[model samples]
Target: MESTAGRLTRKTAIISGAGSGIGAATAELFAREGASVVVTDKDGSSAASTAERIREEGGVAEPFTADVSDEAAVIELVAFTAQRFGGIDIVQNYASNRSLVPFDVAIAEADLSVWVQQLSVDLLGCVLTAKHALPHMVRAGSGSIVNVSSLGAWLSFESRPAYTTSKAAVIGLSKSLATEYGKQGIRCNVIAPGHIVSAGTENMYSDEQTEVMLDHVSAPRLGRPDDVALAALFLASPESSFINGQVIVVDGGMSAYAPMVPSFRRLAEAT
Candidate 1:
């Protein structure tokens, strides 16, 4: 019997915001699956740490510090990846600005700077990354771009207007890329992840708040970074060759129905 090779064998991937959370997990998993990984982040030290861990685990990885909001930085990052790895096959756009939950407000009350900052990092960053990386993939004759959006893009939030807007825009941007590039052997897709337990999330929500949020999820537990990472792996691999211009929601079925109905039904049952 012949043995199966790793799904990503000979593939080279650049994963932005890979210093932690879903990005970090995806980076590591991609490496294990045989992709040469470029782990990049806005935080230099954090990027180095993630790269070092991948190296320790016997995976090929390199660390680069880049603020994706800056086109020059993204250009440099793409150039470096292609130069160091020979070409780019996969790009996971995951870098995002710090959570603006505290300051983000309804449009009527939102500051111009708030919208600018949020879109610069969340939306424009993905654009810049794709813009610079596309040529490399086109030249390679095949490539995959997996963009990380948010479930917030689908749900209306009383606050976080900027975040939701940016995320929703990502979906549109991805579809456009897929349409333009599919014939060129390039595919683009969006991953809209729901609430996941991560360092950033732990800082953002209290324990009580977490419990309340979990009640809305149909899954027995809240999502983990690996859950989304695994989804990314499949999308980025050859298995998804026919999957393009799609959005995969990895939210543990949180968005499947009216969350309040489930809680209200439980309350009625108890009564």
Candidate 2:
């Protein structure tokens, strides 16, 4: 089997949301795997730091800052990558924000502000990035897109209506793009990640909740950023040329198992 590190030598990649979390991890990994990486983030400083880290490791990388939801910024980002790296071979759409508002409350009390905010970052951002990058990839006759969605797209979560809806829409959009561009030699795939440990989860999960979450997963721990990054690498590489229009779940088997039930018998015995 060919190692993934050598798989991307002489290729070029563009990754959004490359400041932190999964995006940052994937940017570094892709660079190590022999790609000239373009790391773009809304945060210029963080994106620069990520690019510097890659350079320090003797890898080729450049950083750009942009709000991916903006059309002009998206166009500029695509142009910058193509100009700098010659042509883009891989694109990882990972820019998004999260919400914790309950649906009923949002419907009854809040305006559509919350909904639009989530959609702007999670749904429209992907579309804008993909749209701008498509023409370049089409001209080259080859490209791969790895969209980062959430497991909440499939499983229901309370107080997260906006996030859920946007993620679900992302998968749908990815499939449509794949179908439309398959004959054009472009592949689009979505990855729905579950319970990944990040800033949001660190604040959301209580100690007890964390323990319960681990019990629900086949893996003994919560999902890590690198876990998803590695998956993104596979999807972005030519190694997955035959794989397209698919949504891969990376939730440590949480989606495959039934909810964990606390033992009432044990409770009674303890009492």
Candidate 3:
């Protein structure tokens, strides 16, 4: 398929929050697939390390430091990529900054300042990146954008209203953009990953909590960062050209089943 035709050869991809987790994983994968990847994160050291690893793997990569929520920084990031790589064929917005505390506490106990900080980075961040990157893409008349949302967008959990709201909004935003830009040759999509195992998860779940979560998943094991990255690659590639304004849930069947924790032992015993 022409969609897979050189699979990113000579193409350029810009990913935000590439310092860790899904962002870092996607950056490495895109590089490996033959794209010149620009890795950006608020943490310079971590972003640099991600880029270095990609370089070690014979992939072309570079690191930059930027806060994706900042309008000026986002604009600069777009410009920098164009200057560095000549043009951008793919854009992935993966920067999110929010402490996963219970929402009720934040609403009742915390100040307004805290709320704004959460929305500014998580919800507004994706908007800002798309706003800045779209025009560059429109000028070229073709591009693909993959926005990283989360399973929280669809289902409710304890203590994370802000994060959930923000992620949910990303799906709506992507759909709106996709509708507006389809004629312009720019395809916008969302990838909602559920319960990925990473440093972030270590902070969010205890060992027991992780086990309970995995037991509920239809897939046998917890999702790795590479799993999400590979999905992003398909959406970003021409292989999925007809796909637009859609949210792909890569959650090991977590979203497909009931919300309660499952008992693997019980199922096995029945068998």
Candidate 4:
């Protein structure tokens, strides 16, 4: 077995949306690194399962069920975490309203409700989490907030206006938090992932779409949940103490250059 580094030793972390995918992966990784983790999600069973697995691995973790969109729920979640784990040293705002993707459409065709719902869970959730957690961190005079955004925030998608807009807002939120809290020792950063293979997003791209995506990516494979999880770990750890108000793109260089270059090269090669 490989030895654990204990990068987060003595730190207590609250990871929202940790029932599955990137959130779950990040929760597990944080535990292994020595943080006492509070794994939370709207799905009670899923949250419990992730916590159970962490415990099975001999790491300290507890599961809580709360909808991040609800301000009351978020307030209670933060209190519970602090009471259970002593204090909040780190917070990973990983919960997002991805189910609204189907309803998310172009601005002209977009439903008002869809935009509201998307922002409630994706953008407002992060705000609520930070709002309730910041005081705890401020009291401690040191903390880290890792908010998960999406590459869609930077790249233009065909549709899903609501999703992209909310994600882009999260980046702005993170930067604001870093600026306001830096003197108090709080650091805030973002992880913008691209085409990650995660729960509920496994079949996001069709076979043909996947091939086109691969051609644009610099890496050999699409991103995995662990790929983003590792990035979260870095921001959460003291290793990035000096890093704040930054956006770390976790894509396989997909957004690095012109999107059509890969297809142009392939066409030339075929000719």
Candidate 5:
């Protein structure tokens, strides 16, 4: 059989939250594309499972456990990857504390804990990962860093104040990294995903919300993890070497239109 060479051949990638959802999908994709994938997640079993899946498909991968919210854990995670892989060429910050039930709370109803916890996972986590990973990338003189943000960063939804704020801060961080590290041969980018389907959202969507998504998104169907994975792949590879400090919104054109636009309204009742 002919070998399936890829853009990331011989590269090393460290992906956080790679046990499931977009993180898992990105890890699998990165491995398939020929990078040595370091998959980390809070759930040891899931992380192992993801790595095993990649290995089953003839990809190089290993599992690690880390809580992105904890500085010690994040530091250890990066150190472990550098030790295992010899160096780091790519880093994808895909970790977040995705709250299913208590995510959409108004500020007045939310406690300080909510803000702290959300910022810790959604924002500080990325900072910690990048802070550690950049040194390796700088030494190598070339590296790509991709951070996973959300569409909520730009658009206003129900009532996810904390989530929205944290995501918005991600955009700022991305730009700053691009500016400070561009001269160092390091590239930093952010991915803003739309309504991607995952285990967490398998049953989270209501009928009305589904209709809204269908209308808002330009793509005929909802988003899959593969969709986001493809974007991350581009950002991590040399194909996007010149693209830095940018937000690649993977929303299927959902965020491109206004709520009252005729096109959105047309799709709302097209069925």
Candidate 6:
């Protein structure tokens, strides 16, 4: 086993969607914590970049190209991780896909393909990853699975019916995994992130848009990829051994202060 000076010493983790954004951040964070990381992404080059960076930083890591939505690919991914690291210990199922559809449209007007596409990658992908990885974790007597969900799962602020529905299902699936597999020493939890500035979303945050978002966000600054990464590390490490089947919202207090007073109003009223 490869041990380091950090919390995850001697542990191995499989992170899906590790090509960029929160996935990449989590992979790098896990490595720094003394974990041997298997960085899997649909984009082979992106996955390799993340793994190479980890190695450069004196961590154990490797990249694999796998589509979480595909059962065969998921199975192969789990097998490869177990073979390389001796057994599976952690899995962060974070891969997701969504179609660009205006939120104003009703679900009835939404295209069926969008629903299938989003569900396949976001919901079913998590299931397949757990299904294949659990047996190994079960045999090993302990494991942690952190499924990345979105704040949209619980809030109505966003559109994309398929996207919201799929994300919500993730929380439900994670709870089931935790309840059913708790006896085996395997834990599953959900991480719900809001307004994270990732590679996939940076361009969408215009100055005006950011100002509006800040009005809703109680924190001084917007959320970051590391915020979510650190939360995942906690759930994946021994520090959270007794924590399972819970939803950790990393939104900088956005959800907590929902229906907040408008920023303009706060400014006009002053303190």
Instruction: Say which candidate scores most in lDDT.
Output: 4
lDDT of 2: 0.85
Cα lDDT tens digits for candidate 4, 109-134 = 88899999989988999999999999
The per-candidate count of clashes, in order, stands at: 0, 1, 1, 0, 0, 0
TM-score, per-candidate, Cα-based: 0.95, 0.91, 0.92, 0.97, 0.93, 0.93
**What are the runs in model 1 whose C-alpha is more than 4 Å off?**
1-5
Give per-residue lDDT, candidate 1, residue 155: 91
Better of 4 and 6 by lDDT: 4
Q: Write the per-residue lDDT of candidate 1 for residues 1-271, one digit (tens) a residue.
A: 1112578999999999999888998898888888999999999898899899989988899999999999999999999999999999999988887667787887888888989998998899889999999999988889999999999998976789899999999999999999999999999999999998876577887889899889888899999988988889989998999999999999999899965788688999999
Give the alpha carbon lDDT tens digit for every residue of 48-144 in model 5.
9999999999899989999888889988988998998899999998887767246549888888788898888878988998999899999999999
Which pairs of residues collide in model 3?
102-159
Q: Residue by residue across 1-271, what tens digits does model 3's lDDT show?
A: 0133348888899998899988999898888789999999988898999999999988899898998878898888889999999988999988876354533244466566656766787778878888888888999999999998899897877666677777898899899999999999999999999999976676778889998888778898999888898899999988899999999998999889653435556787789
Better of 1 and 6 by TM-score: 1
RMSD to the true structure for each prediction, in A, is 2.6, 3.0, 3.2, 1.4, 2.7, 2.9
Clashes of 3: 1
Show where candidate 3 strays beyond 4 Å.
Answer: 1-6, 98-106, 259-271
CA lDDT of each candidate? 0.90, 0.85, 0.85, 0.92, 0.88, 0.89
Output the TM-score of candidate 5.
Answer: 0.93
Q: What TM-score, to 2 decimals, does candidate 6 have?
A: 0.93
Give the worst 10-residue stretch by lDDT in candidate 3: 98-107
Instruction: Output the better candidate (3/4) by TM-score.
Output: 4
Clashing pairs in 6: none
Ranking by lDDT: 4, 1, 6, 5, 2, 3
Model 4 residue 261 lDDT score = 82
